[model samples]
Target: MKTNTEVVTAAVVGLSGWDALVERYSRLVWSVPRSFRLSHTDAADVYQCTWLSLAEHLHRLRDPEALAAWLVRTATRQSINVLRLRGREVPPDRWEPESTLPTPEDVAIGSDRARRLWAALTTLNERCQRLLRIAAHSPELSYAQVADALGMKVGSVGSTRSRCLAALRVKLEASR
Candidate 1:
């Protein structure tokens, strides 16, 4: 498969390339504003603005591989701008910076959550932990693949997942 950079480079040279890029990044462009919990109309506006901005600047992109990041950053900015235009006040702390690094407070909260999650996982039997961990982190894993990996029937995966999740939830609530 061609890398995003290659696809973007192709896009700059012809209509096909531009269409391909729109197909590839449209979801990404739409998702960022939605992540901020924007109204559907606002999100649509941000999505359109992000793409329009991208179209204007495509020729100046120094690295086409950074297209995804660019779209996300653009979408985020556009979302915030839309909020501001409506006089909506997003708490400063609630804002995500264009840089992806977590803030210190975010790191602390995330660390505590991770510790709790790991402790909860440890309370599960090895099989439950293994299944949950694989399924949660690896979206690419199909039900058949998970069944084969865990030596279970594919039909059983959903029920097993529900039981394991209930078990994990019980553990989490108990810890709290």
Candidate 2:
């Protein structure tokens, strides 16, 4: 399998590298909306839109090696846009129960703690949330990937992470 860097490099020169890029990052893109509890159809739309946006911007992307992060950031934004559009529609009062309950391991995380953590995450600016999410989920991403994704200087990821964590901690504690 081609590494992300090789796939993106091939894409830049008009090779068949886009297929590889899509295959490499499509699941990561889908996970964004899945995390948001978007319906399968809605999540698929976000996935398609993210890939289309990436296709349009690939030539101009600042760092080919950071393609994973770029796709992740794009997917996150597309999911948010999808949710906002959905929010504008009349929400149905009746809701169907989920087909499956969460796993025992998942349930072990107390609901109150999860709620507080989610609330704390929301207290962060969008960039911070994106940074933390990407960093947390994909530790393989280098500082360069993160910087390219979030439009920050490479030197600042650690400092920014520290500040964002402190902010989250403050919010979490204040909520208690």
Give the best candidate by lDDT. 1
lDDT of each: 0.89, 0.85
RMSD, every candidate, angstroms = 19.2, 24.7
| C-alpha TM-scores of all predictions | 0.48, 0.49
- The positional error of residue 126 in candidate 2, measured at the CA in angstroms, is 64
Tens-digit lDDT track for model 1 on 35-149?
9899999899999999899889998999888889999999999998987877866768889887878889999999998999999999899889989999889979999999999
lDDT value for candidate 1?
A: 0.89
Q: Write the per-residue lDDT of candidate 2 for residues 1-176, one digit (tens) a residue.
A: 77666787788777588877877777789888899899999999989999899888887888777877888888888889988998888666655457556867677767878899988998899988998898889989999999998899999998999899899999999999
- Clash pairs for candidate 2: none
Clashes of 1: 1
Runs of candidate 2 with Cα error greater than 4 angstroms are 91-176
